[model samples]
Target chain A: MSNAERPDGWAITSPRSDRVRMIASLSGRSARRKLGMFRAEGPQAVRSLLEHRAADVRELYLTDAGTAANPDLLALAAAAGRRIRRIPEDVLRAMVRSGNDAPAGATGSGADGPVSPQGVLALAAMPEPGLDDVLEGLPHGPLTLLVLHEVQDPGNVGTLIRAADASGAAAVIATAGTADVWAPKTVRSAAGSLFHLPVVTGIDPERLLPALAEHSISALATSGYAAQDLYDAELPERSAWLLGNEGHGLPDAVLQAADLAVRIPLAGSAESLNVAIAATVCLFETMRRRGGGAAR
Target chain B: MSNAERPDGWAITSPRSDRVRMIASLSGRSARRKLGMFRAEGPQAVRSLLEHRAADVRELYLTDAGTAANPDLLALAAAAGRRIRRIPEDVLRAMVRSGNDAPAGATGSGADGPVSPQGVLALAAMPEPGLDDVLEGLPHGPLTLLVLHEVQDPGNVGTLIRAADASGAAAVIATAGTADVWAPKTVRSAAGSLFHLPVVTGIDPERLLPALAEHSISALATSGYAAQDLYDAELPERSAWLLGNEGHGLPDAVLQAADLAVRIPLAGSAESLNVAIAATVCLFETMRRRGGGAAR
Candidate 1:
């Protein structure tokens, strides 16, 4: 398509341009809601979006260095028929708050910022899959789902998503008061796992409980002080693990609603594990129990 | 003693002062090496230093608000006979590169800086506990130790320390090329767990392997491609789990030196787990095997 005909074909050079401002504003909830779009920065995240959810990617922006370094990703984006725009490094830097100058070769993981300027970024349509849609599309047998309640830290939210994906969880549900999973930091920390499965956000636990029951998914709330140890609990074949906020943990009402309340036993001086770590331990334990063969 | 007579009793008011420069410079390797000291920032880290290693706390600085909020820590410092000085918040901010204006009540955990200025900071002597000393001081019965080889992120290092503490690991040893465990960010991420266990730095694996052999601690190196799954491996009563850098697995030599190589079996599309999360899984598995009761 000719540059004039393509909607996203403008070469963005000015950091102060409206397009840059709009892309940068994806960090905020209102901006994401108004724009109906969110950003995935660096090669890994952008590549994952293009690879898994190509139809959702609206535009791809690349600098000379980013293009040179990510030829395969460019090819994938082209195959997926995404509009590509060339952007300057300064413009790319302005699109994110921190780590804009990270080395181009970095894997976009374990770095300082949520969005590293790895020379490439993408503006993707928010895939607001409905809870019923996700429930209807569940994989055949022994399903694992993760429910995040009031987990406010973006890094923790992202890490949990990545962990959930790694543990073979079918989908993730973020209840009200949770951090925005579409936030740049959350996208980066997820390390591209966000695109791997269905994620439903802005959910209410009250509505979710009955829906989960309809789906035959037992909700297990994780608590630090629960009398039932994690190992002793018989995790169901179809389970939804409820992880809570880092500081206050699951509210008493939510704990009461869960089919079972389980705790990861602590053996040392640390009072508790980081929520993400705790979630991974629980998810993997469930995976292990369902004959996923991780233990073998 | 009078303020003039006390070696560390100077009230710092200027951010540009030499004392502030020295404290700020602790972020650098050469500065830490030359001064033989590192910084512990925020109230939790500072309080831990005073409580556990009072002799290592050379000096403590606190703002009026900090002193007021942390009365117990102040009394502990006084009881430990460490030098204490009062400073302005601006002066405290000048001592750290970031989060100088963090709210006085914030836990100083999620602020936008490597080091959060919690109105309190301390310069503590680097307690380079000898390998023999750590071995001799090990708690009776089965022991767990964490050995970090070349892991370069300060946050990861700190989280690993906290995880190690939570898993009941007796101590942690950071090999060369690893992020400095004494760095301010590491201290903050550790959340005072550094005080709960002995940490040894700059130890060569060649020497450590022999020392571990002498102590009958089996070395288990973690890798992503290992044929032996973590769940199936027989964890020894006394074990040293070696975790490598974020980007790279353990060096071939280090992996070869290990008594056994094991991998955490991942079931999803995630190629690998975060190093801290991986370490936690391995450490807890070891705990589970040694009757630490995580699985019981």
Candidate 2:
């Protein structure tokens, strides 16, 4: 709201103060798709880019005050041989959506002409598709991959990413129907996984299956009432854990394409697990098989 | 917002629409201080209440049309033995905070309110604490009580409670600083755990220490850089798991008060685990110790 005063190298004053645009456009996968980039706010996200050496980063935008508040963010971009741009509050506020409402009106990534310009947003390349990499790309043998089939909530998608990242999964592959992992909320919910790991979105399961079959892996889908528990099954090393849409879950077609459906064990009366938690159970089970459970 | 024909009952309306003396007092714990009560609007929160069987469900206020669309809600309340009331739509819309910028004295739950109230809400009672069963006389056997200190996110609080419930721990105690497990968001996140189990808020660790000392269960604090990994530690049956705040983590006093500080192993660059996830890892570890791992 006030006139911006930033560092020497960056220009702080706005050319048009009253007529600022907010980029809530990052809310939609399509919008993200058009621009080939997404929004990243907060100190954690900024630090993640530095930690992972994110290859897609074209710009590092921040508030001059944000730079003053979060020196770690400044250190991050600087250490990575990147510059931090001091952006406007109106732009940042426009791009960011609080937990108040799920972002809406995602017509396309670049469909609209400058919907909003936030304090900091990036134009980065989409993570490349490598389904085979998901199956066998880790340092050890038989890596695990989390395959999300139309899981709609960005928060759920992001949480799953965070959990998957924590378990040291090979990668996360999202079908075209799943919520965009790069959406601002999903990215925020993912904490920093988006920066540290591979997140391939907008592919069809039809296209993904053959590549997975080539890797000699099994796709284990999670069902609410299936008899066996996720931990009960003899989890394999090269396994793809699939979590479906929230209400309908995976359609018959998606499940028919997978190896088997497993259930997370429930002792109580919960009709279901949150999609993120369900995915986490599946992922950790694989990690457990991979000796992630062994003492450090 | 249209009104549906109401049955021969009292005035059917939206509580949010009735612009009366609304207490937007979220400043301290006082407004929330009154246990067994809070406000929320949204499809998800309402659905969670229907599922949870919370006992103090004092009233069900709704516009006649809301009742028609979500008849399941009516059936659920009846099944739960709750009372329902219906109101007008214009009144209800007026009750809602239209935009994020809800001015004080607007008589609505906005910004902090849940998104989308389907013309209905229920005032439910916070379940009676189950400390009576767990700490009835401070048993001599091994006991593990989990304590959450100032975890601010309502969802995180709820998830932690779910983890506590899932692990079958004796009870979950919250310090004065922790988030409210009974808040609508927390309840939704807990997935009805609040009804089936005990989440005691506003307690002093000092009070619990003396109470549990009889059981000889030492406190195990968790920190990112602790000396030992939780998986490798020799956990006792009578231990207490202490998890701290999300942003700031556990305060110094809470950690210092603990018998030991342990860390979950991390092989990846994730800065930290979700507090709830970290607690689950620890609880499941304990469950495994108690030989529940054989269930798999």
Candidate 3:
């Protein structure tokens, strides 16, 4: 085996190096857009990126500990003929953006030590899946699409993406006001689900509603005050589950535009479910009605 | 009106006062235990605490903005014979611990501004509900209990508590190693559900399992790899849904002790669901089988 192929060779040790700073810049929305790349940090996300979207990965870095811990991931990347560079702890830490993985109120490398990226970081070309293309590719069966209408929390967006993937949704459509799907916090919270399905972002509601109508997909608005109970309603064969902002729910116009406003039954005194939880319940209920896990 | 009853007659303006520092220390686990008090920050949590558990609240503080924003809350507190004090923004900020209310990486009042507590904060004696008393009070009909087995994230713990309340669970029990139920982050994430149901913490599995049996409440372990599908299984009328740690999952011995092992069906390529999502799915499924929204 070549020395270059060994885990310890070709280390990047400087925290302030130009290349490390350039990679770290991907944490911000503008930098990602300018560079045409987004970052996937932590072991689970990087492993998924390598396994599912290996060709799109522009660069991969791992700390010495990261390399030792993820032998299988290294093997997978190597098999995919991807280059992996070993970086020092500081460099890896430098590339990590303060996000969901670190506890809140945690400042830079204080008593709790450095904020970790879980040993792996990957920069990949952001996949831009258009709504038209996503609609065109649907199979001839009951299909589900998860829509985020101005859901601003990055962590909630990421969790919703994972829920959409778990429930076998065809795609995730994020409105313009939604948190950047590529934000570091979203990527960390997504836990590798981003690589599993088509994610369309930055589309306006005006554009999306017409597109759904054109595609013959029913738009179901989830609300706490709706008259229709989700369980009692007859769900459409193909539908888009619309979840709105965390504080203010879907606006009146949007709710009116939807084919139906469905409310998840809150059995107790809770005024509403967390937007992410509400979305998951809706998606999973669709799965249950169509068929059980076997249908997936 | 008396000077004390008015919102702005007396104010706390100093962030470094002994009172502010003492309240700030409640953020630590040891301080909370030692003082037998925990904090509820932000408008929603404070409102819920006052409306639902007014007697338990020892003190309440609100900024000018908070008072202006929540006139109805003030009336509720007054009606309940609770004292409400006005504090300046700096003092309010000082009393808030580094928690979920603040975004990650936000250092002490840096470029993005101070970590806000959403204009209000409260200190309350923690409610210590016993497992035996909770079990004995269950209705004769179907009942649900949510169990967190060493789930460590404060945000996830809080979200799970909210989900349990939404699903009409009888109580939420946190085993040893779970996040502090009264931590600021958990309370914030819970949104207000903490006041709606009994939450028992610092429990051990050895004690929990026997307690469930005595109550004839089936213990259902939720796992990603369980043989029995959640939708397909014949669920018990009374049961405790067991959710394990984020990284390690439920210990094997606990899984063995469970009356049944249940798995939520994942239709997509994702290997598992988030712990909060998994617990919600299970709790909601119980509600679904018994009836729909009317069951509550």
Model 2 residue A89 CA deviation in Å: 6.0
Ranking by lDDT: 3, 1, 2
* DockQ-sorted candidate list, best first: 3, 1, 2
Clashes of each: 0, 26, 0
Quality class of the docking in candidate 2, CAPRI style? incorrect
CAPRI-style class, candidate 1: acceptable
Number of the top-ranking candidate, with TM-score as the measure: 3
**For every candidate, C-alpha RMSD to the true structure in Å:** 5.0, 6.5, 3.1
Runs in model 2 deviating more than 4 A are A1-9, A15-30, A68-76, A87-123, A130-140, A293-296, B1-10, B14-36, B39-55, B62-81, B87-113, B117-120, B128-134, B137-144, B289-296
Q: Which of the numbered candidates is closest to the native, going by highest lDDT? A: 3
Shift of residue B151 alpha carbon in model 1, Å: 1.4
Expressed as tens digits, the lDDT of each residue in A53-121 for candidate 2 is 556676667765666676666566666666666666654554454223333222111111122322345
Candidate 3 residue-wise lDDT, A155-221, digit = tens:
7898999999988898899999989999876887788899999999998998898898888899999
**Model 1 segments more than 4 A misplaced:** A1-10, A13-17, A86-91, A97-110, A139-141, A293-296, B1-21, B62-71, B78-88, B98-111, B114-120, B136-141, B293-296
Question: Of the pair 1 and 2, which is ahead by DockQ?
Answer: 1
Please give the distance, in angstroms, between residue A163's alpha carbon in candidate 1 and its true position after superposition. Answer: 1.0
Work out the TM-score per prediction.
0.85, 0.80, 0.94
What's the lDDT for residue A192 in model 3? 88
